[model samples]
Target: MMIIKEPKELQQELKRRRFEAAKQGRELTVGLVPTMGYLHEGHASLIRKARANDVVVLSIFVNPIQFGPNEDLDRYPRDAARDLALAEKECVDIVFMPEVQHMYPQPTKTKIQVEGLTSSLCGASRPGHFDGVTTVVAKLFHITKPDFAYFGMKDAQQVAVLSQMVADLNMDVQLVPCPIVRESDGMALSSRNVYLNEEQRSQALVLSASLKEAYELVQEQKSTTAAELKKLLTERIEAKPLAEIDYVEVLTFPELEPISEQTRLSDYEGDIIAALAVKFGSTRLIDNMLFQKKDVALHV
Candidate 1:
């Protein structure tokens, strides 16, 4: 596996590989898995999906642009040696570990922002967050030029926003959303999980529990009202002494538009995602579940 630190060098090498494959009458399918430096099972799952392609490039850059001023940018996480070992285990073709200077040699004058989709959820809480996300992703897509970009469903909002950006910009890349990797006890795998102490870690289960409760309520009780679902989720998280609710939102999937309190579950005809962000001590975590009423008519 090649460990490339320079953006230009990696771009040139990928271009050469594509040209060579074309000359040999071989169709090359390249896949890219973009991630921050802390590699975990969730990231590994993305790599596994990318393995189906002819070449897989995993980027391990902790993008500063995507982080807010007060966010964990400085102390996010990093272990190049460990990440490389994990990528090697997955048989990744390339590991792009570009420096911040290499990724943005000068002050970035331009930014990519997806409107409407960024108006709520993580976007509402973290201003300019999606702009940073879309900008860096756009740069990565241009540099790697992969046939498909793999992203985990854990960051559902990020996936949705990027999908819109790709479609609007007519970028020649397909975004593949993988399922969320979780622990046996139902905690969603996150790089920040390392920061959680034993107590805080246990408390983090509330996020998953709330999601499960929401799923069950929709499935068993036929609970479909957004307000009632949010109230139930809030109550579940609030019951846990250590868990603090950041936001519990029930919105339409992909569109991400808020559902009115008057909207009934039976009236809604498509997938609805119940997403929540909670804080345990200083560490914040997010989890979500997507479900729809069985009796609701499918909308094509």
Candidate 2:
């Protein structure tokens, strides 16, 4: 219910709330849901999960550091009023929406880099992007001091990288990865979805469509190789003239290492993530499905 702007103020307020709860002989647990200013069902799902904790703190800062030089930092969609209303609807206890200057009083010299995870997927295409991501999220973890932090699995690579950072640094927070919330038609939810025109929006479904088909093929034991899976995804998305392929990667989940081209789905012993990033008329949309190998077959 409270919207905090200053970092110190948020820390003080959380401390005060913890103190009050302690006096009542109740231990306080804080949950943090970090996001940019646009609120969608995907973000709402994260807040709902955070609500399990005693206090749900949502930070809606569109981190400038995360955006590359040519990326859409300037054009990133934002609706503070709508976001705040949604937060209120979700019963969020605190909304930490800080300005760019407040977050970075001066240019930051410190950067947290998790090496291998940063070399592929979105990181492969956008250099220094994950550095920005890790740096900003680290700042948020320090500022909010939450016992648990919630992130959507749509950005699975991010979950992997941040998890590494947390473990490596001994940070005292549990990273909760939630499922990808999608439209009825299967298009993954994203704030950038606003940039899609009618035509592009319709064609964008190919991303999810391809992923769904890929998931089925893996599940049904179609006897396909990793290379074949990538090709199938590529061909399907390429069928949509408007869809431009950024990367269609079939990599090991969390590890994100490349599976050999000849490696069949059945032979793979761990979790696999088939991720796609495609651009449709200046708007880039990403969708992926995790294939977990339980026994002879893979389950999504």
Encode model 2's per-residue lDDT on 75-100: one tens digit a residue: 89888999999999999999999999
Top lDDT hit = 2
Each candidate: RMSD = 2.9, 1.8
- In model 2, the runs with Cα more than 4 Å from the true position are 294-300
> In candidate 2, residue 5 scores what lDDT?
93
Q: Give the lDDT of residue 279 in candidate 1.
A: 89
lDDT of 2 at 210: 87
Task: For model 1, name the residue pairs that clash.
Answer: none
User: Model 1, stretches more than 4 Å misplaced?
Assistant: 292-300
lDDT of 2 at 138: 94
